[model samples]
Target: MRSTLRSSPQSTPAFSLIEVLIGVLILALGLLGLAAVFPVVVRQQRTAADQTQGLIVARNAEAYLRGHTLTTTRSVPNASVPGGGLLAPSDPIPEQNRRGLDILRYQGVTATNPYSTWSFNAANPDRPGPWEIPTYSLVYTNPDRGNMLVAATNQTAGVQFAQRDRLWPAAYSSVDTRVDDNKYANEPRYIWDVATRRVDPGTPSNVGDDGIQFAVFVRRIDSSIRVSRRDLINDPNDPLRLSRPTRDLRLADVLTGDRLGLGGVVTLQRAEHRVAVAVTNNSNSPVPTLNGEGEYAMPMRMQIEAIDDPDGQGLSRFLLPSSATDIQRRLLREPGQKFVDNLGNIYTVVKATFDKNPPNTSNPPEVQPENERRSILVSPAASANAAALAASGDLQVVFTPQVPAAVHVFTMEPR
Candidate 1:
């Protein structure tokens, strides 16, 4: 029997290989874009959180100053300063020695030199008897340290003894283990300083209506090494245990030679006991330092070097000391990095650039490109004639001894 060939049923249309690949490519691109955005979102969140915390700390400081008034006076031994002065049994009590006083009194309006030149303020007042030029004082806090704020010595205040009189979160007790624990070893601390100025020097008739202004500065402390504020208070020798030069240390010597090497936050004990984080992790991979015997050399940690900005941007450049090993040249480029001049003028790092392997352009290779100096541009751009200032023996912008995570300048009136 002749049976007609049955036609195959029409097959359902399916995606071709090329079309599937194209779809996958589109999906992958979208996923990659999301991956990139995640880190940015996380960073933004962290920054916002830090800013909120800073503002809170500042407000807290204002509350403390307004509520706690310093009335008692302390005597300083003249012999400790001015060397063998027959002047008085003790040095004259400093005017700023006291805090939380009414505006008229703190401003010294009745004194012979009303608005006496405060070293922290400008030499010449701008036309007013009372301008709020705040004098700063540093305070360190650690949650593990029994939630107390440790007041650091303020040589800027001129009356170091008065620091003890300032209001503290908790009363000092000889039996308190928390107070003593802060003296030994505590890593990862938070540092904030406060300064108060009389915003309104009330008239003699309305002296009670005066208002006080507070400026609070908060900095991030990324120190892995111990910071002993108590030692600074009590011990005469080896405070902070930073006597050992970090420049002498090798990769193997720090943090027990982690596989990541001496990267990330580095404790610059000699750099005013300030803690610093590396600009980037990629560049911090420790390069091996071989000894004469062809073995890995073990030395102390490398010390950071502060180089003047060749571009005349003030203290805007940094490098590793000549003794630096492979761990040198890690720039402190984190945004909002706060540095303070000797005069307590805070400078924030807005930008940073590091030439990992800059071209060496010297007749006989004067310096290696890898050793090129890095640049950091801070706000309040230093005078264009920074070199001239240095030559004139003026105070150049020096971020003495410490770099904190962030600096917040807050103007809070005492409530």
Candidate 2:
């Protein structure tokens, strides 16, 4: 064979070094373009999902409203109100937790929020101790002591005892809703008091409805009421029980600490006593009757809070609209509540007022955002009460988007 320089195929240059480099560059550019489009695709998907959730929530709210007849929405007329409502007395026990003052005060001004007012024990005729309470007061009896009546001294419904005669003609007389600041160790969560501009703001004025029902006339034993003690110089029940303040616990000394640290110092070992209680308006009676008309009956008010979810994930601020007032806005922006997600997604709330005047006669009970906050009345008479426990008519309790109209709003974060 002629020894020609038969170059093997592998020896030939398949591509120059520049060509290889260019190929890599093109591939990299294509990958970069894909990466850029990835974020856009994600953002669009997220937006669609969020908006769908918003509509879903709105319809859920609408269905809920429709299901409630004019009756079920009525609450106690004087719930959480000062100088309002009635109280149903227990059957009467002699050895009640009548430990405090004869001129005793319960969940009155000292312990209650602005929505609820406090009063002294109201009694006139026979003084049980030294003085009978003069104003309306809430009393708690020790269940261990046989559910005895620990109330203002001896009296029937007379001039001094005539609190129940005040009639509640209208079905829904009052809007029983109030706001309460969140607290830990008696310290308020935030400092800025937009509603009242309270300087200390330990417990300032409440703003929007907390979206929970409160009782006007609270009967039966409320398990939440109990007693707790704090260290006074030393733990009262210490091993040696060598508490200096406990031995000399005069009211003056215990209350003011006798200029000692025990004034504010209390035992942290809390003990629940049926006799000891911190009363709230929830335990008071708003509609008391000489007859048993309002027995075990508590007035309940509608709140614009989050709705119940089958999945247990509560509704976010889905109904909160841009038209919310300054106080309403602050209420919606509760601390630590996540409104937006990490992926530039947000969730919002859109709610309608139970008292909106001109109903959205159009489609799907759609009230204007402004009208959603207007206080309305529910005066269809208590005759309709509990009659429509189950929903009926074209008005159904829908939760999904099968309903054509929107009653709520949900929004995601803008990209």
The Cα local distance difference test for each model comes to: 0.33, 0.25
TM-scores for every candidate against the unseen true structure: 0.39, 0.22
User: Cα RMSD for candidate 2?
Assistant: 22.6
Q: Which candidate number maximizes lDDT? A: 1
Model 1 segments beyond 4 Å from truth? 1-11, 62-335, 353-371, 383-405, 409-415
Tens digit of lDDT per residue, candidate 1, span 1-415? Answer: 9989765656657789999999999999999999999999998897786677665655555565444332111112221111000001011111211111111112222233332222222343221122222212222221111122212122112222221122122112122223243331222223344333333333333332333333354444323433323222122343433542222222111212111112232332222221121111112342222111111111112222343554654445433344433343232344465543322345666655553333444523324443354445566654434333333333222221123434533333322
Candidate with maximal TM-score = 1
Kindly give the stretch of ten consecutive residues in candidate 1 with the minimal lDDT sum.
82-91
Error of 1 at 69 (Å): 5.1
Q: Can you write out model 2's per-residue Cα lDDT over 60-161, one digit (the tens) per residue? A: 433432332321121222323222112222322213321121111122232434333221112211111111121224334332221212122122211111
Residue 200, model 2: lDDT of 13
